[model samples]
Target: MTSEAPLPKPSFMNALITFGLIVVVISYGLFFLKVNLHSLMLICLMIAGISASLLTRCDFSTIRHAMSEGVSRALGAIFVFILIGVLIAAFIQAGTVSALIYYGLQFLTPSMLLPAGLILCSLMSVATGTSWGTAGTAGVVLVGVGGAMNIPLPLVAGVVVSGACFGDKISPLSDTTILAAISSRTDLYDHIRSMMYTTGPAFLIVLLVFWLLGQQYAGNALPSSQLLLMSNALNNAYIINAWCLLPFLVMLGLSIARVAAEPAMLLSSVIAVLIAVFMQDAEIVNVLTALYSGGGPGQTGVAMLDELLGRGGIAAMMWTLSLGLMALSLGGILYKFGFLQVLITTALRRVTSVFNLVVVTILSVFAGNLTMGEAYLSITLGGQLFSDAYDERGVNRSVLSRSLEEGGTLTAPLIPWTTGGAFMSATLGVNVLDYAPWALLNWLNPLLGMLFAFFGIAIFKPQAAPSANHSTPTDVSFKSVN
Candidate 1:
């Protein structure tokens, strides 16, 4: 048998070609006709094959080997995704989330409506470590109430999502927050504390905007009788007390202590389950069932309580976990093929200054959100790409990290196909595009990153300029606003 010629070395041009082919295939598969995920997977494999053959000048076996390695690396993240789902499901089954909502609704009225709604959603999002959960639960009800009060759904949804996302972005227990810290090798609590500098401002601005809107929409207080009616409606649905808040407080405290995310969440889940059993006398078998579907049999007479309480199980997380793994696998293939290296190198060549670097990083993250459709990818990939650049320039890692969070983590929800976007859409019944503009934090983040960079705000580093001739600065003083 004749021996085949050796493959050529991969180049930027080849990487570009590979990326183009992948993009075209995805666009065609997703848009041109309805295709199942299996078909999509096959399409990806075929595209990878063609790209490898032409771009890498490699044999099918070599390409397959790289692809297998890439797919294997994603298993860990897939498991975490499943656990996150289980945690959410457990919280729901235990009536932890419902109890919080029921108590909040008791105080909501036309007078304190806007601030209360914003704060309530923010609190829920912070408690759950998920804006999607907050939006799906309290967000939907707020919209219904808005409609009842003859208010605009889009505007209301916008405020609700804004508040929820703000909480998610800042909350220490947030998955995105955990991912950012881990990806950047920073302490989770430190990162969260650092984020508060910008997050606080952003949150205040969003609240103020919502408050002004409320002034116009919140016409008059629902009379005392109506308030009482609302209270009765809440009371009739579910029993509420201090115990309901324990799981959230425990989770938040653990998170603040910089505890590992999975354990903290698991512990919180356990507390929720125990609370449900002891306080609510929730059925154990029913709790197990609800962990998958995000729904379980609640009380028959109380529609609101049943609907609110019956949500989020392990089954609910499967789709997200599967998609996350698939994206990771695809990303891994691209990385192993040297596509990411080529892209980063090309992007880095143009960045001659901090301003440009900030801009590029922001754009790259937003692009990832648009492409990969997930905040975790955006934060992780952005950190991977930009961390070294920032370090070389004598900039603090926190600056680059916070920028990634602002650009990548918070903005994924604006994309319709993104994990956050899909979760929010499914939960709130609001189109991604509909609330995109109103998601003040999402849009403001990149702007803040750029603004901070240009203004030299909060960028910690050695005072000496970076130059080959100059000796390295020995005294490193870390200064952060938070």
Candidate 2:
């Protein structure tokens, strides 16, 4: 392959100005002007691309090539998002999500609802590996149940958000988890195992906190009539049996075995479709429609039942895909033009120790989430920015992967205008600000990651010589402008 012409170097101030302008526009557009996120992001891409070309005096064709390459890198994640949408629809039609909600509601007493909701949501998110799906389905049901029990809606939303984020952080099927591993060039399973050291403790602490808080509502209970109605509605709408869980079990088993995420999800979705047709007795045409447009509008004549069961499909994912593409395209232009390299190099010069390196990685990833309003961009860009620093310090790439997830994936739900936060807020009917304080896991995971770095706990070091098997550090050559 022929080497491309080197890009002109812009001063740090120029780079800062370009980035600052993009952030201001995005922030103002999203929070103040109420512009659609996709539009704002595309605008940012245009501004950044145009500004980079002018400042560097580079050909626009070169910039376009770089942006295309960047988008290509993220294509895997984009496809997975579509698959998740379809899987969610299939699961709903087959009674997979309904079964989870039905069984979960059975054991939820007011006194134990908070902790139970957290645990159940965590299990569902872990099984499905999609926090959006978990929150949209199980989280919504738990919110209704909590309301009936006289428990605080914000508290219930917090527990649900925390559980969903926690499971998403570690699940092999999760898009964020997969993205982090891919960005850092680490083994996917290895990256997951590394997160447990921090995630395990954070989860336990959240469970305990929720349990203690649940005690205040010990005397409150859902009216028996309401409980009976919900249970009966679910039973009448779909087959609630041990068999409904087979798809989830199969997906989880495949994930554990390191099957590629696409195939695993595809197989599970197909299984769910079969169950929907045979066990649930759903019409083939209706099932197919649900698989494309999501299920609902009262199959069981229960408004609540219809709402809870109606979600997912390839169409459902279009919004996320659009945002993902825009963010990645912007990132691509920035990286291609050397803006990212300049910023990362400037930051690395200040790092004198492993602790500093880890801290910088965390901060950079967090900043990416805040500015980009998307986790995929943060993980991919942050990983590219810091891989060299980690390699230079002899830190394991898995640590970088874990750090990206902690800062980018987990924190996404806490930001009001971010994709994750927006989806959760809309899905759960709780504002991001209202539920953020209670979404303990969303904030705690990052702190735990930094804390581990501070103490060097579970931080693996590279051998004297780099292993041939490990991913090479990303190259960030610094060439001066002519």
The best candidate in terms of lDDT: 2
Clashes of each: 6, 0
Worst 10 residues of 2 by lDDT: 473-482
In candidate 2, how many clashes are counted?
Answer: 0
Question: So what's the TM-score on candidate 2?
Answer: 0.80
lDDT of each residue in 235-254, candidate 1, tens digit only: 55445577867876786677
Instruction: Name the weakest run of 10 consecutive residues (lDDT summed) in model 1.
Output: 473-482
Highest TM-score scorer: 2
- Residue lDDT tens for model 2, 391-424: 8888888899999998888888887656677667
> Model 1 Cα displacement at 72 (Å)?
6.0
Give per-residue lDDT, candidate 2, residue 377. 71
